[model samples]
Target: DQQVKQNSPSLSVQEGRISILNCDYTNSMFDYFLWYKKYPAEGPTFLISISSIKDKNEDGRFTVFLNKSAKHLSLHIVPSQPGDSAVYFCAASARSGSYQLTFGKGTKLSVIP
Candidate 1:
């Protein structure tokens, strides 16, 4: 069973357009959510995060919205640029333990010039 899922393997958008990525989870115990952006052959960098207690979190061009009832979350990038063409991974962790995060396969967003 995939505890976390990103249904779309890739997405393409024009520069200065909005890019939206979707994610879903099956575990109800997850209390912390995170979004990570990665370049080729590099580790993911933390983009934004939201706790289960909150529904929305935003940072700069990135925003994450969580729907606890549906066990779903999404990431939105405003005015996407060519630099934004990278893999985005959605991760979640429970409150217990060392806060180890589980990740989705990732969605590769390609921004056209």
Candidate 2:
């Protein structure tokens, strides 16, 4: 079974500062990883992702790093803004053809201005 852990329930960062969210997993079968940002009453929006073959993937202000050896990953947000404050989820999927996603509880980010 696949299990994801986001030990930190929430994070607080100053505006324009950097924010780092951590995630850990117990499943090696996962081949795809993703980060999503969610707001109240709205569905989560995709942020970034990394394939099992890649250790790191970046897009604009977001970067996702995966450590296959330790089954761990982290998402970094540079120059965090107030609008960036939202609940972030770390999700994983396997290439077993099922195409199912397993998600961590989530970490709420608070970017204060």
Candidate 3:
């Protein structure tokens, strides 16, 4: 019954390469998609997010793409660095305007140098 799902539990990428994280959702009512990065013993920090109305959003080396029709989303990090290694969580929220969000299990990303 998990609404948001990250099929891959972990992903490994070479330094200076591109790291692509994928996420899927079963609930069509989701109006927003958010990606969070968590470091060891630290709270998850907001990385990037995309609204359902847009297909893609980019910030520096991070890019997020959303395919509302397919209920799929992805996060791309170019020139992956060791510091970028962390657990990334995909979350979604309905149009209810409430802060409650459905989160995925999260994908652990390891950027090897």
- Segments in model 2 whose C-alpha atoms lie over 4 Å from true places: none
Q: TM-scores of the models, in the given order?
A: 0.96, 0.96, 0.97
Ranking of all candidate structures by their lDDT, best first:
3, 1, 2
**C-alpha local distance difference test of each model:** 0.95, 0.93, 0.96
For model 1, state the Cα shift of residue 54 in Å.
Answer: 0.7
Model 3 residue 90 lDDT score:
100
Worst 10 residues of 1 by lDDT: 91-100
Q: What is the lDDT of residue 89 in candidate 3?
A: 99
Per-residue lDDT for 9-112 in model 3, tens only?
Answer: 99999999999999999988899999999998999999999999999999999999999888999999998999999999999999876758899999999999
Error of 3 at 5 (Å): 0.1
What is the C-alpha lDDT profile of model 2 across 6-91, one tens digit per residue?
Answer: 98999999999999999999987899999989999999998888999999998998989999999999999998999999999999
Candidate 3 vs. true structure, TM-score: 0.97
CA RMSD of all predictions = 0.9, 1.1, 0.9
TM-score: the better of candidates 1 and 3: 3
